[model samples]
Structures are given as C-alpha cells and as structure tokens.
Target chain A: MKNIFTIIKKEFSRFFKDKRMVITVLLPGLLIFAVYSLMGTVFSGMESVDENYKPKAYIVAAPQNLEETFSSILEITEKPSLEEAKKAVTEGELDIVVVFPSDFSQTIGTATPPDVKIFYNSAERNSVYGYTFVTAVLGQINTSAFTVNAASDKFDLATGRDITGNLMSTIMPMLMFALLASGCIAVAPESIAGEKERGTMATMLITPIRRVELALGKIISLTCFALLSGISSFLGVILSLPKLMGGMVGAEAAAFYSVGDYFMVLAIIISVVLVIISAFSVVSAYAKSVKEAGSLISPLMILVIVLGMATMFFAGNVPHVAIYIVPLLGSGLAMSSIMSFSVNPLGFALSIISNLVITAAFVVLLAFMFKSEKIMFKK
Target chain B: MTEILKVENLKKSFNLSRKQQKLEKTYQKVKVAVNDLTFSAYKGEIFGLLGPNGAGKTTTLRMLATLIKPDGGNAFIDGKSIINEENEVRRKIGFLTSELKLEDFFTPNYLFGFFSELYGVDKTTAAQRRQVLFSKFGIDKFAEVKFGNLSTGMKQKVSLVISIVHDPELIIFDEPTNGLDVLTAKVVTDFLEELRAEGKTIILSTHIFSLVEKLCDRVGIIINGQLIALDTLENLTKEKNLEDTFFELYEKTTGDRI
Candidate 1:
C-alpha cells in the first residue's frame, strides 16, 4: 500500500508540477465552451425567419363570409381574375395566390366542396410559410367536414423537459466518451510507455515493490488526471448546453437536469474513465514507447466511438444486460438512460460493476506484463 | 569466504526477429545469450565477469539482478532465488546498468526519496544515507536539479545513488564504465574500491581487461556465453598478461584466430 501510494504520489507530482501539462488538461474545457456556444449562435441565426415580414397574397373570387379571417394573416390584395393572380405568383412578385370558387366558403361542408387552388413555390422559404399560414386560416373558417389538429391547445404533448431529455440522451453520450477517451489518451500511455522508452520504468522494477502495486498506482493516478480532463470538458458542455441546444430543443436542457441527474452521470463517467485508463495502461505496458502505444490505442479509440454511438441506435431499449456489461458501451448505455430519465437500476449497477471488474482484470494483466522481461525489455 | 551470490547452470536465449536475423546473417531462429554459466562471489569481494561485447557478460549480470528470467536454471542472492523470490532478491541487491534511468522530470532529491519508499527504507536511515552518499558523490551540490537538466556525469551519478537507495547487501553493475571519460572512469573505479572497503559484495561485467586487473579480486573470463577461465587475478596473470591470456583462451575455446 505504501509503495502504491509512493508511486501514485510520484505520478501526480510528475503531472501537476508541469505547467505545460496542466495547461493541456484545462485548455479543452475552455475550447469546448467557446466552440459549442459559437455553433449554437450560428445555427440559430440560420434557422430563424424574420418576424416583421408578412406573407403577400392575391385572393381571387374571394368568398364574402371568409374575407375577414384571411385578411388578418395575409396582405390581402385585389386582382381582377384567378389567372392574373397565378401569373403574379409565378413571377415571384407575389408570395402566394389563392382562388376560392364563387361559393367556396358556402360549399365547404358539401359532398364535393369547391377545390381551393393555392399557388406557392415549395422551394421558397417564404412561400412555404405563406402556404401554411393561409391554409390554417381557411381551415378555421371553412368549417367543412373535419379539421386536422386545428385549434387544439397543444397537440404535440411533449414537454420542454422531454425535449431536453431526448436531446441529452442522443448527443451527450458520444460527446462525453470522446472527451474522456481523449483525456485518457493524452496521459495514460505517456505514463507507462514513456517511462519504458526513457528507461525509467526498469528503475522501479528493480525495487522490492510488487508489479501489482506499480500498475495500480499508475492506473489510479492516471484515473485522477483523466477525470480532471474529462470533467473539465464535461462542465464546459454542461454550461454551454443551453446555448448549444437552444435552437433545436427550444428549452434549456441544462435547466431541466437536477443535481442528482448530474451525480448519476458522474458515476458513469468515473467508472468509464477507470476502465479506459486501465485498458490504456495495459497497452502502455505492452508498448515500447509512447508513439507505439498511441498507434496501438488508435483502433481501440475507434471501438470506443462506435460504442458511444451504439446507445443512440438502441436508445429506448438497450437490448439486454449483455449490452450493459460490454465495458465502454455499457457506460454509454447507462448514462443515456439516466440522462433521459429512464434509469434501469439493474442495468446501471451491472455496468458499473462490470467496469470495475474489467478494470481489475486489466490491472492484473498489466502486472503480468510488467513482470515479463521479453515485453518490458523489447528493443 | 562467505558466499553471497551463487550461480548454477544459469542460461538464457532469445528469439531472433527477421530484421535481427537478417543483420546477423543467419537463418537460426534463436540466439543463445548465456549458457550454463556458474560462479560465486563472496562478501567483501569484487568479482568481474570479463568478456568481449555480446559474450553474455551483461546477460549474466541481468539475470543475477532479476531484470530477466533464466530459461534453464536459477541463481541465488543471499540464498534468495532470483526466479521464485524475485522481490526478495531485488530487496537484497542493488543493480545498475546504463539502461536503468531516473525520471528526467524529477529532482535527484525527490527520486532518492521515491526509490527509498519503494525499497521500504525508514525515513531516518534514508536521510542519513542520503547525507553520506550524496556528499560522497557530490550529488548534494545539485540534488534539487531535475535530472534532464543535469550534466551527463551528474545524471549517471544520481542514477547510481538512487539504485542503492536502500543500501542493499549485494551490488551488480553491468559495464559500469563503458563510455566514460578517463577522469570520470577513475571516479567510478575509486567508488567501487570504497564499496569493497565497506565490505559490500560487488559483481561487475566489463570487456576492459585493465579494469578487471585493477579492481577485481577474482575474474571469470567468458567467450561466446561460456566460462573459459575462473581464477584469482594473480593466478590468471601469473605467467601471461590478462589480454594475452584472454586471446589464448578465446582461440582455444571457440577455435577462432585472434
């Protein structure tokens, strides 16, 4: 235990005392915040339509009874005939043109109602909105056979919280995995493989300290660093969640999650970080240098990305407990479930337990590798 | 003499990579590095394994240091098996080679404390040992300097100091002065003599004949992983000088012209 603590202290000092490394650990958080917020602002600008602009319409053979309702939505214009109104709309001088048969409003409820011809370009954004607005007004006044979703207080039935939760479950898992894996990549390999390359690791191997102690110490200290890096970026995403998701979700997702939700997510993050760091630590022990370890870890990184995305495809029903026990992917599943307010107690417990077991197995494998001179002393 | 290290049929071999096989100009899949080597060193003595480069001198010492495993047999350090009791063996011996490096990020002072903790040394003894050894090696002058910033000689000295942070009963050095300037070389040779005077058993491997003659109490001459001569310096050098005896043995043992 003392030896493990000693090794951990050494590793911590190696990282914390280096100003450049500390900067690297914190810079991602700041960068994430700035980039995400900028994306939100830019995306929102592109999707919004100007509120001051009204749809222009030329109504021909207008029904006297419905005239009052149509005038409120469209800029009602006078045209002599239906053919002239269609020509004006085709020329793009008018936003929309509508022809109601001579007794259209009166015939709306009859067996064969007069067909209202609305001419609007589907390709034009303004024309699309114009067509929609004009149809809604006609639907209200026509009082025909039936209206689809007309004047029902709120038909969608999804709350702001639901939207926020859906957004979180969809996007957060991938982003979180990517950020945390990157953090592990930045430090874990360099700790073991860098020491091997520099010839410093063998110095410790010669001591009375057990290889298990060395491996544990390295993994734990590296876990702390990875968490710092993962959390900083995570906090950045959380703080910027409102800005980044505002355009799509329409509600602040950040405001919907409670402290308990964050804690649950944090639990998954820690377990995931442990598993990643331990696996990478084993890779580092197997590799001869940091560059080699990085090459080896690249394929594993791709695997992590695929796992992170796995939860999204199987979002609502995470097939089986088998899925929850699959290391990195399991953490993603549990986190998505928690963030979306659909926590499965059994699956969550299984994923975290499986992570710890996998991490322990990796540590033992790392210790075995440490004792192998063939691997450690490979030229 | 009280034997402190015992070697019995210790052997090691390595698989040749294709690139290595190509470089070695051979189709053989394995290279025998150390072969059935046997010897003993006693307390208060410096035993030198003398051989040309690649003659398994370093390999033999590496096995004794528990840095590598022996395929065929085992050795003992203070009666602890290098294979079965590796941790205990490590606790009993201080092994240094050019390959064992101190972290460049840490000061010598910090590394000494870190290694001492690994060795399970008490703080008071560690402090006292540090005071004596650091001053002796002149490491105290720059004890707080990060190893990367230290001069080459200082870095080597710091590595040597840290290797024996617990002051183990046995010391093993592989090519202790392989690439030293003459002045730095003399300092190392003098340190070995000082260690001997303190009654610590030392095992060193070197190809330099003069170094063996100047410092070793007994010498084992190895050629192609086989021990060809084992005797006191006086007995080995009674009729012929050390170099002539080595070449004569080399020609007789391997049937190669010198």
Candidate 2:
C-alpha cells in the first residue's frame, strides 16, 4: 500500500514538473475563451434585415393602381427584359421578379388562378428570405383584392429556437467527452509506455508492492486529471452558452440549461472521463513506446470527436440501446440525454457501471502485462 | 560457509521458429536458453558466473531472481524455493541486470525514498538507511542530482543502492561493471569486497575473466545454454592463467578455435 502511494505520488509529481503537462492543462481554457469571444463579436456585429428594409420588386405588366397598392412596401425598379431580369436575380441584384402575362387582369378575373411567375435564384445564399418576403407581399395584395375577413394565424417562432437550444445543450456534454478523451490521450500513454522506455518501470516494479496496486494508482491519478479536464471544458462551454444561444437563436433561447442541468452534465462528463482513461490505459499497456501508445490512442480521440458531433446532429434520437452499452459512445449518449433534460435512469446507471467495470478490467490487464517477462524485458 | 543460494538442474527454453531453416513456413521449436545449469553460492562469498555473449548467464541469474520461471528446475534463496515461494525468495534477494534501467527524472534521494517505501521500510528507518548508504557510497554529494544528469557510474551506484535497500541475504548482479570506467569499476569491485566482509552472498555474471579471477571465491563458466565448468578460481587456473582456462572451456563447449 505504501509502495503504491509512493509510485502514484511520484507519477503525479513528474507530471507537474513537465512543462508540456502544464501547457496542456491551460491551453484548452485559453483557446475556448479566445474562440468564443471572437465568435460572440462576429455574431453581435451582424446586420439584421429589419434595420435596412428596402424591398426590391420586379413588375412585368404595371397595373394602373399597382403602384398605389405597393407604394409603401415596394421599391419599384425599371422593368427589364426577361433575360436581364433572370441575370439580375442570379447576380443577387434583385430579391424576386414578378412576371405578368399579356392577359394578367383577365387571368385573375377568370375562375382559374392567374399564373404569376416569381423568378428568384434559389441557389443564392439569402434566397429563402427573399421567397418569404415575396409570399408576404402577394398575400397582402390578395387581402386587398377581396375584402372577405381573413384570419391571421400566429406562428410560434420560439418552438424552432427552443429545439435549437435543446440541440446546443446536447452538444455541450458531447464536447466535454471529446475534451476528456483528448486530455487522456495526451497524458495516459506517457504514464505507462514512456516510463517503460525511460527504464523506470522495472525500478518501480521490484518494490514489495503488487503490480495491480500500481496499476490502480495510475488509473486513479489519470482519472483525476481526465475529470479535471472534462470539468474545465464543461465550464468553458457553460460560460459561453449565453453568447452561443444569443447568436444561434436569441436571448430567450439561452434559458435551456439551469443549475440542475449543469450538475447533470457535470456528472455525465466525469463518467465520460473515466471511460476514456480506462480505454487509454489498455492502449498504453499494449504500446511498446510513448510514440506507439500515442498512435494507438489517437483513434480514440477521433472517435470521441465523431461521436460528439453525431450526438449533436442527431439530438432527439439515439439509434439503439447497444450504443449506450458501447464504451465511449455510451458516455456520449448519456451525456446528451442528461443535457436535453430527458434523463433515462437505466441508461445513465448502465453507463456509469460499465465505465467502472471497464476501468477495473483494464487495470487488471495492465497488471498482467507488467508481469509478462516478454513485454517487460523486450529490448 | 552456509549455502545462501542454489540452482538445481535449472533450464529455460524459448520458442524459435525452425521453418526459416528449411521452407519459409511459420513453425517454431523449443530452443533451450539454459540447459540443466546447476550452481550454488555460500554466505560471505563472491561467486562469478563468467561467459561470453549469449552464454545463458543472464537466464540463470534471472531464474534465481524469480524474474522468470525455469522450465525444468528450481532455485532456492535463503532456503525459500523460488518456484513455490516467489515472494519470499524475492524478499531475500537483490537482483540487478545491465538491461535494467532507472527512471531518469528522479534524484537519487527521491528514488531511494521510493524504493525504501516499497521495501516496507518505515519512513524514519528508510531515511536513516538512505543517509548511511549515500555517505558510504560517496554518493551523498550528488544525491539531489537527477538520474538523467548523473554519469553512468553514478546511475550504477544508485541502482546498486536501490537493489540492496532492504539488505537482502543474496545479491545478484549481471554484468555489474560492463560499461563503467576504470575508476567507477574499481569503486564497485571495492564495494563488493566490503559487502563480502559483511557476510552477504554475491552472485555476479561477467565476461571479464581478470575481474572474475580477482573477485570470485568460485567461478562457473556457461556456454551455449549449459554450465561447462564450476570450481574455485585457483583450481580452474591451476596450470594456466584465467584467460587460457576461459579459452579451453569455450573451445570444449563450442568446438571452435579460440
């Protein structure tokens, strides 16, 4: 027991003494702050359409009173030929072009609805807004044409914004998982394979301590470092939440994650850190050198990033129960679930329990490897 | 002198692919690394197992250290069977090999503390023992220097100190002076004499015949995974010098000119 503690203490002290480790711990926080602050500034500086409301419209056959009806809303432009108008729309010079056939009034008078061709470039970046504005203008003209009472339907803009906020909430936890995996990869391999390469492992092993105890002590220390990185990332995302929400939807969308939600996210993040550290421990043991260990564990970091993004894109529905049982993916799904405030107790419990089990199993595997003369004595 | 360490008909074999000798197929056969090797070291004696490269001396020492299990035999350390009671055997032995490396990030003092703790030495006793060992070895002056910054000789001294921190009954060193300078080598040889005076059993493996002739009470020669000769240095060198005796043993085992 004392030997194990001594090894653990020495490992941690060596970690702190390395300049690379200190930079690793601080770099992520600094990067998150810098990146989000820049994003916030860019988002706040965007010019809204409401501020400059000049509605450009193309008229084909100018009705005598058409000018009067749209006098306030429309900015009348010179009627160009069809080819010129299409070119203008393609070039984004015109919002939408309305073409009236030769029998415009006659077509409207008949029972058949008049075919008023609205030409706009759908490939244009802001074409969706152009289409919506054109539709609103047409509706106003119809309302004026027939004075029958028309009921206005109120659309809840908040629902779409709320879903987006929920998506962000799901994304934040997954990001935490990725950060933990990255941090673990950066440190765990060196803890084992690096020591072996440096010829320190044999020195530590001959002590009266059991190999399993040493393995466990390393796992515990790594878990602590991984969890610290996870929490730091969680806090980074949380601090930037208001700014992200404001830019993505609006201020009202920022209220999705409360203190309770934060706590759950934190719990999920810690579980995720454990799972990653455990996985890295196995890889580290298999590696013959620190470089080899890094290569072995690099796939894990990539997997975490991919899983986090997948969880974000597929927020509401995780595909299968089997995914929740998979090592790193399970933590990601559980974290996403917690962030969305849809806690499945069974899934969460399974993730935590499975992580612990996997960690224990890896520690045992490392102990066995440490005992192997083939591995330990390999030149 | 009482026998403190013994190896009886010890043998170790490793799987070597034989298909490469014929076709390019992948089949392996057992190749003996140490074949029926037997030797013993008594208390207060410096025993040397001398051999050229690939002579199974290391394999023999490793078996005695309980680092590896022998294929066909057992070793006893302080009356404890290495095969049956490995932990007890390990506790009673201090094993070192040239291949064993130290963590370079630690100072000698830090590493001493670590090994002392692992040896189950209490904090106060460990500190006292560390001070005494450092001073006696003349390592106290640079005890705070990191192992990486220290010379190879200093590192060897530190390795020796950590190996014997618990003061085991049997000390095993493989190629202890292989890479040391003349000065450092002399220091180590002198230290081994002091350890012999203190009644500790010392088993060393070396390729240097002169050093073995000077230090060893008894000498054993191994070649091609077999112990070819075992006797006191005087008897082995009765009619010839130690070099001629080594050449004769090598020729006898390998059927080669020396």
Candidate 3:
C-alpha cells in the first residue's frame, strides 16, 4: 500500500506539475463552455425577436368587425388581390398572407365553418411563428364568440414538467462517455508505456517492491489522474449543455435532475474511469513504446464510444439487469438510467462490481506481464 | 573473506524464432544465452566479468540481480536465492546497467528518495545517505534538474548514486565506464576503488581491458555463453600480459569450435 501511494504520488506529480498537462486537461472544458454559451445567447436573441417583432401580414377581404382585434398583433397591409398577397409573402416582403372568406364573421355559429387560407415561408423562423400566431388569434376570436353565446366557463390547464430533460438524458450519457474516454486516451499510455520506452520502468522493476505492488501503484495513480481529466471534460459539457441545446430544451430542464442523480452519475463515471485506465495499463504493458500503446488502445476507444452510444438508443427503456454485468456498456446504461430518473439500485451495484472486477483482472494481468522479462524488455 | 554473491552453474536458454535464426544465418533454433556460469565475489573486492559483446556477461549479471531467472541452477545474493527469494535478493544488491535508466521526467533527488523508500530505508537515514551521495557526485548543484537535461556522464553518475541509494552490501554494474570522458571515467573507477576500500562487494562487467587492469582484483573471461577462464588478475597474468592471454584463449576456442 505504501508502495502504491509512492507510485501514485509520482504519477500525480508528473501530471499536475507539468504545465502542458494541466492545459490539456482543462482547455477542452473551458472551450466547450464558451462555445455552448455563445450558441445559447444567439438562440435566445432570435427567440426574443421572434416573440416581440410584428411580422408583416396582408389580410385579403378583411372583416370590418374583427379589424380591431387584428390591428394590435399584425402589421396589416392592404393588397389588391389574394395572388398579390401570396406573392408578397413568398418574396419575403410579407411574413404571412391570410385570405379570409368574405362572410367569415357572419358565418360563425352557423352550419358551416369558414375556410381561411394562410401562406408563409416555413424555412424562416419569423415567418413560421407569424403563421401560427395569426391562426391561433383567429381561433381565439371564434372561441370567444361561441363562449359568449353558450355561456360556458373558460378553462386553462398547465403542467410543470420539463420535456427537454428527456432529450438531455438521451444525449448526455453518450457525450459523457466519449469525453471521458478521450481524456483517458490522452494520458494513460504516456504514464505506462512511456516509462518503458524511456527505459525508466526497468529502474523501477529492479527495486525491492513486488510486481503486484508496482502494478497496483501504476493503476491507482493513473486512475486518479484520468478521473480528473474526465471530470474536467464532463464539467465543460454539463455546464455548457443548455447553451448548446439552444433553449430548445429549457435551460432549467438541466437542473431538473436531483442531486442524488448526479452522485449516482459520478459514481458510474469513476467506475468507468477505473476500467478504462486498467485496460489501457495492460495494453501499455504489452506495448514496446507509447506510440504502439496508443495504436493498440485506439480500437478499444472506438469500442467504448460504440458501447456508450448504445445508451442514446436505449434511453427511457429499462435495461436488463444482466446488461449491467458488462463493463463499459453497463456504466453507460447506469448513467442513462440515472439521467432519465429511473435508476435501478441492483443494476448500478452490478455495474460497479463488474467494472471493479474487470479492472482488478487487468491489473493482475499487467503484474504478471511485468514479471516476464521478454515482455518487459521487448525490443 | 565473506562471500557476498555466489553463482552455481546458472544457465539460461532462449528459443530463437525462425526469423531470428534466419537473421543470424544459423540453423539452431535454441540459443543458450547463459550456460553453466559459476563465479563468486567476496566482500571488499571488485570482480570483473570480462568478455566481448554477446558473451553472456550481462546474462550472468541479470541472473544474479534477479532481473531474469536462470533456466537451471541458481545464485545467492547475501544468502538469498535468486529464484526462491528474489525480493530479498533485490534488497541485498544494487544492480546498475545502461538498460536500467532513471526516468527523464524526474530529478536525481526525487528518484533517490523514491528508491530509498522502496528499499524500506528510514527517512532520516535516507536523507543522510542522499546528502552524502549528492555531495560525493557533485549532484547537489543540479539536484532538481530533470534526468534528461543532464549530460551523459552526469546521468551515469546520478544513476550510480540512485542504484546504491539503500546502501546495499553487493553492487552489480554492467560497463559502468562505457561512455564516460577520461576525467569522468577516472571518477567512476576511483569511486569503485573507494567502495572496495570501504568493504563493499562489487561485480562489474566490462570489455575495456584498461578498466579491468585498473579496478579488478579478480577477472572472469566469458565466451559464447560460458566462463572459459576465471582467476585473480595477478595469477592470470603470470604467464603473459592479460591482453595476449585473452587473445590466445579466444583464438584457441574459435579455432577448435569452427
């Protein structure tokens, strides 16, 4: 255990003491935050403009009685014909062209409802909002008239649910996994195989420490450093996620998850990081140089990415308890479950146990490889 | 004299792949890297294992250091078996070679403390030892400099200090002065003599004849994975000078074999 701490201290100092490593670990998160915040600001600005700015509307055969209602919301412009109004809308001079039947107000409360034709550009945000707003306004007028005649009570119901949380839960699991995997890839190989390539590992091996202790030390040290990098990247994404979502999902929806859900996610992240670092350590032990280790680990990184993406597809669905017995896949499912607010304790337990077991197995394998002179001193 | 290290016919063999055999232009697939090599080093003496490159000197040293297990037979370091009690063997011996390198990312001071801790040396004792070694090697001036930034001679000196950080009884160094300048070489040779004077057992492998003449009290000449000759330098040189004797043995062995 003392030897393990010694190794961990060495690795920690090697990483944190280096200016370049600190920057590599932190820059991604800061950049993600800035980019996402900028996106959010741009989107919010567009939304505010869409809400307040009156879109130019041309109403053909306007009813005199309803002119007062239309005057407040729409920039009403006169057009000679329905064709001319549509041409103005299509040419972008008008946001929407509304064609109301000549007897639109008179026909209300009668046998048939009047046909109203509205034309607007669907590609433009303002134009789309203009069309929906005009139709809703006309419908409101019709409803008010009917309510007055029938003496009915007005009804309004709203639910305090965040629909965007579901979208975030579906996407965040995969994003988190990819970000953490990248963080591990950036540093773990250098800590292990780099020592071998530089011939420093032999110096360590000749010491009085047991091979198992050395392997344990390396694994633990790498786990802590890799976990920090992963967390930094995760924070970048999590803090900036609302902005990147462009308020399509309400920013408040990100806070909808309980604190316990975050703890559970963090637990899964740590477990996943241990598995990743251990697996990379084994690959590094097998490699002759840091470059070779990187080449070998690239395929494993891709595998992690593919497994994490499975969470996106499986979001909102309950995963089988057996799925949580797999390493990377289980962590992904567990995280997805937490974000979706349907976490299963048994699944999380199994996932954590499986990850730890896998990590231990890899470390043992690395220790055994360390004992083999041919492997350790491979040309 | 106390026998600090003993090798009893240690043997090691490696299977040459088809490609390796082809590259060597040989038909034998199994090559014996170390074969029935036997030697002993006493306390307060420098034992030189002299041989050409690929002559099993390193293989022998590696076995004694417990870096690789001998295929047959065994060795003892301070009475600890290389095979059965390697960790204990490691505690008794300090092995240095060109292949065993200090990490370029670390400084000599940090590595000294790290190895001392691994050897279970007490902090105060380690600190005292580090101070002594740092001053002895002139390492105090650049104690915090990264190993990679040091000159080759400086790196070698630092490596030697770190190897013996725990003050082991037996020291194994392979070609300690292989790449040193004349002045640095003198320092290393003088240091080995100084350690010998202080009653430390030292075993070193070298092909340099002058190094052997200057530092070795005893010499073992190896060829083709076998120790062909072993004796004190005075006894071996009684017939002729050591160089002529080595060449004569080399020619006789090669002429008889091929």
Two-way TM-score contest, 1 vs 3, winner? 1
Candidate that beats the other on TM-score, 2 or 3, i.e. the better one: 3
Interface root mean square deviation of every model, in Å? 0.7, 1.7, 1.1
> What lDDT score goes with residue B126 in model 2?
83
The residue ranges of model 1 lying beyond 4 angstroms of the native Cα positions read A42-160, A247-255
Q: Tell me the tens digit of each residue's lDDT in model 3 across B65-137.
A: 8888899999988889999998998899999899898877788898888888888899999999999989988
Error of 3 at B8 (Å): 1.1
For model 3, the docking class works out as medium
Chain A TM-scores of each predicted structure, in the order given, are 0.71, 0.66, 0.69
Q: Candidate 3 lDDT, tens digit per residue, A1-379?
A: 7888888788887887677876776666677678767865664213223367898888777788767878898888888886777766655577787766777778766776566667775424466678778778777776633222122311100111222344446666677677777778777788889988988888888888888999998888777777777778778767776666554445465577788887888888899988988888899889999999999999999988888888766645654689889888888888877765677889889999999999989989999999999988866
Q: Using lDDT as the measure, which candidate wins?
A: 1
Highest TM-score among the candidates is held by which one? 1
Q: How well is candidate 3 docked (DockQ)?
A: 0.66
Docking class of 1: high
Across B1-258, the per-residue lDDT of candidate 1 in tens digits comes to 899999999999999999999988989999999999999999999999998888998888888888899999889999999989999999999998998888888999999999999999999999999999999889999998888999777877887888788998899988888677777788889999999999999998888889999999999999889898999999999999999999999999889897
lDDT of 1 at B190: 96
True contacts kept of each: 0.94, 0.52, 0.75
CA RMSD for every model? Answer: 9.9, 10.4, 10.2
Model 2 misplaced regions, further than 4 Å: A39-167, A246-260, A318-323, B17-30
